[model samples]
Target: MLTINNLHARIEEKEILRGINLEIKPGEVHAIMGPNGSGKSTLASVLAGREDYEVTEGSVTFNGKDLLDLAPEKRAAEGIFLAFQYPVEIPGVTTINFLKTAINEIRKYNGQEPLDAAQFLKRMREKAKLVKIDDALLKRSLNEGFSGGEKKRNEIFQMAMLEPTLGLLDETDSGLDIDALRIVAEGVNQLRDGKRSFVVVTHYQRLLDYIVPDFVHVLYKGRIVKSGTKELALELEEKGYDWIKNEVDALEIA
Candidate 1:
């Protein structure tokens, strides 16, 4: 559902992503793994239309429309959901209110009538139960004083509420415990159907054990150096990224 071609992005005159080319189809899950400063997160931010990054070249097309040409909110309305590594804390906004605002905003953008309060609350309770998010937690201020695991679960809860066509999960497993990870992964898995896709960006392979990406891509120095199935993730976890880097360097030199 998403196609990126020769993508180049920079922040404050410093380049991050260089010639990133990836194509994601519906119902497919792709995992991007790389060490620090390898531009994995940068790719996610650029794709989500974060204003700080400047796209110098390349084009991203989502569902036959030019994605880069749209604003960030417009991108969300087009069915892109990005789960940030650090979810922001809005002290005055309850989680339910924040989510309701987001859902209504998206609906307005998509030309759909806004959900009534009763309908919205009904859907909220159902999705919250689906993600196993406690009703007590949803009543609190958004991410305010929440534990790391709670924040992560809240992110997945939001995802379940929005039901975006494409989900970009960036470092979702970073601060999650095993229990939280499983819950989040279950939420993601439940949403995986023929009409949705996911790009999971992470450094370690542990998250892949639960998500089981259809494709695993090794990103290095701003580009994907290798792409394979879930087996590649296992091999990387066993042999480390240095081995993959050496192999890639050898192939380039050959």
Candidate 2:
């Protein structure tokens, strides 16, 4: 569903993603894991069309379209959803109203009619239940004064509401306790409908224990240095990243 080839991106001359290449098929969940400053989140942001990162080389294609050519909102409309590492607060906008507008805008972009109040409420209720989000929270300003877990759950709830074809989760497990992690993971798992794909960016293997990626990739020095199954995550947990760093560094020196 998504193909990234030789993808290199930089933020004002400091390169973050260098020579990233990966293929994400329909129904697949790919976990990207690495130590700090390894560009895992940068890849997610680049794919989501975040303006700060300039693509210096390579290309990303989603469902046969040149993904880099599209704007951020265009990417969203094209079925790309990004669950941020830190969800921001929109103090003036209630979560329900914000999501309603977003969904309707996406619908309008696709030449479809917007959901009426009743229709929207029905969908909202269902998604809220699926993600275990509180109705009272949705009525409040988006992410305002919400706990970390609540914000992450809200992100998942937003993902469910949009029903995106590809979900990019940038460290969703960060700052989440075990209970919150499980709740968020379960919500994400429920969205796995055999056609949607996900790229989960995380530093810890514990997240993979819940989300269970089909493929695990180790990214280092702005590139994918290794790719394997879930076993790789276990190995990383057992050994940490120093071994991988030594191997890659040795190769570079050689």
Candidate 3:
């Protein structure tokens, strides 16, 4: 569903995401794990069409179209959903209201009719249950005063509501306890129908325990250095990223 080839990106002259090469087919889940300053989040931001990062070289194709060519909202309309590492609070916008507007806007972009208030409410209730989001939270401002766990879960809730073809979860596991992690993973698992794809970016192996990936990729210094199955995550957890660093250093020395 998504192909990134030699993807290079930079922010303010500092290169990030140097020669990232990944290919994800439909119905597959790929986990990207790396340490700090490894360009994991940079890959997510570039894929989501964040304007701050400029693509210096390389190409990304999503469903046969040039993904890098589309704007951020256009990327969303085309079925790319990015769950941020830190969900921002919109103090005045209630969750339900914001979701309503977003859903309708997405539908409009896709040439679908907007859901009526009753239909929207019904769908909202259904999706809310999927994420274990309560009605009280729905009534509150978006992410405003929500605990860290709540904000992360809220991102999953947004993903559930959007039902994107490809979901890019940028460290959704951050700050979440086991319970909150399970809640978010269950939501993601519930939505996994063997047709949608997910690229899960995280540093810990614990999250992979819940949302087991088809492939685990080790990213370092803005590039993917290793790819393997879930067992690779376990190895990384046991041995730490130093192994990966050593391997890359060996290759460079050779």
TM-score of 3: 0.98
Minimal lDDT window, size 10, model 3: 122-131
Ranking by lDDT: 2, 3, 1
lDDT of each: 0.91, 0.96, 0.93
Per-residue C-alpha lDDT of model 3 across residues 1-254, encoded as one tens digit per residue: 89999999999989988899999999999999988999999999999999999999999999999999998998998999999998999999999999889999999999999999999888888888987988899899999999998998889988988889999999999898889999999999998999999999999999998898999999999999999999999999999999789989899899
List the candidates' TM-scores in order. 0.96, 0.99, 0.98
Name the regions of candidate 1 deviating beyond 4 angstroms.
Answer: 249-254
Task: Return the clash pairs for model 2, or none.
Answer: none
What residue pairs are clashing in model 3? Answer: none
lDDT of 1 by residue, 24-72 (tens): 9999999999878889999999989999999999999999999999999
**Local accuracy of candidate 2 as per-residue lDDT tens digits, 99-187:** 99999999999999999999999999999988789999999999999999999999999999999999999999999999999999999
Task: Show where candidate 3 strays beyond 4 Å.
Answer: none
Which one wins on lDDT? 2
lDDT accuracy of residue 144 in candidate 2: 94
lDDT of 2 at 234: 99
The candidate 2 region of ten consecutive residues with least summed lDDT is 125-134
- Predict model 3's lDDT versus the native: 0.93
